[model samples]
Target: MIVISSGSNHANAQTSMNTWAGATAQRVAYSTSRLQNRPDSAVTRDVRSALWRTPNLDASGIRVRARLGTVTLTGWVPERRQISLAGHAARSVRGVRSVSNQLLSRNSR
Candidate 1:
């Protein structure tokens, strides 16, 4: 009777493992479909590029990262206003959901 109980427990464990694996696979597929449906990623890239090329704003030292419709501006700029400008520029983008201005001011040379 003990041996039979052990076998049942093993079977239950295997079943649980299989369920977990199926759940994981479903999650992966869902994530992939969601990502494929995301339309803002391309817009974010375009916005970053436009910001980088905007006149009067020095984008050389700035770094831009975007995820899930949010754009994060990092690195350094020469003036405080540049940080705001970067944020504004990012916001002007068509698909930008939000902008996080993390730009640091650099001392003048």
Candidate 2:
């Protein structure tokens, strides 16, 4: 009886997986590449989100600007290393064509 129940469950799972796959096949995949066609404001938001997600990077004071695919980051980070990290993060966003990192370390500023 238990074996029969497990087999039934497996069949249901497979059916659900197929349904989900079929439903999602035509759905858009949200990733960095999708941001390429987005506007500058959208690019700015994506860059800001990227900086906030970067490890060991303090983004509390960071300000992001985007213009014609050019990104400018201004503000202060807790550490000098975070400046480079912020730049890299900004550049990784798909819509960013260039980065002007103006981040100053807290101690340096």
Candidate 3:
């Protein structure tokens, strides 16, 4: 029987474990991103519905997009307050992680 060095073996094993851990972390991040993005369309629809349901807010010219639970509102609103209203409505929807309001008041143009 031959005796092997324990220190060398431990170092090599540790290196392998570290590599595996890094790969696993990357995979977990990727999976989480996909899960977050999976409901984007539903988020968009819900935001649009919220805007429509808001009083004095005309959603006809508004467009909504969602990614990773982040909602983006683009387009125009009739009144300046409507911009904030649209943003608030979008934020009120469930699953919305954040809101980017790009809406411009038609009166501002």
Q: How high is each candidate's TM-score? A: 0.59, 0.64, 0.64
Q: State model 1's lDDT.
A: 0.78
The weakest ten consecutive residues by lDDT in model 3 span 1-10
Look at candidate 2 and give me any clashing residue pairs. Answer: none
Q: What is candidate 3's lDDT per residue for 33-108, written digit by digit as tens?
A: 8655448888988888999999989999999999888898999998888999899999999899899999998873
The order of the candidates by lDDT, greatest first, is 3, 2, 1
In model 1, which runs have C-alpha deviations exceeding 4 angstroms? 1-41
Write down the RMSD of candidate 2 (Cα, Å). 10.3
Q: Which should have the higher lDDT, number 2 or number 3?
A: 3
User: After best superposition, candidate 2 residue 104: deviation in angstroms?
Assistant: 0.5
Q: Between prediction 1 and prediction 3, which has the larger lDDT?
A: 3
TM-score preference between candidates 1 and 2, better one: 2
Off by over 4 Å in 3: 1-38
> What lDDT does each candidate get?
0.78, 0.85, 0.88
TM-score of 3: 0.64
Candidate 2 C-alpha lDDT tens digits along 1-109: 1123546887777778887886676464545456546698899999989988999898999999999899999989988999999999999998788999998999734
- Sorted by TM-score (best first), the order is 2, 3, 1
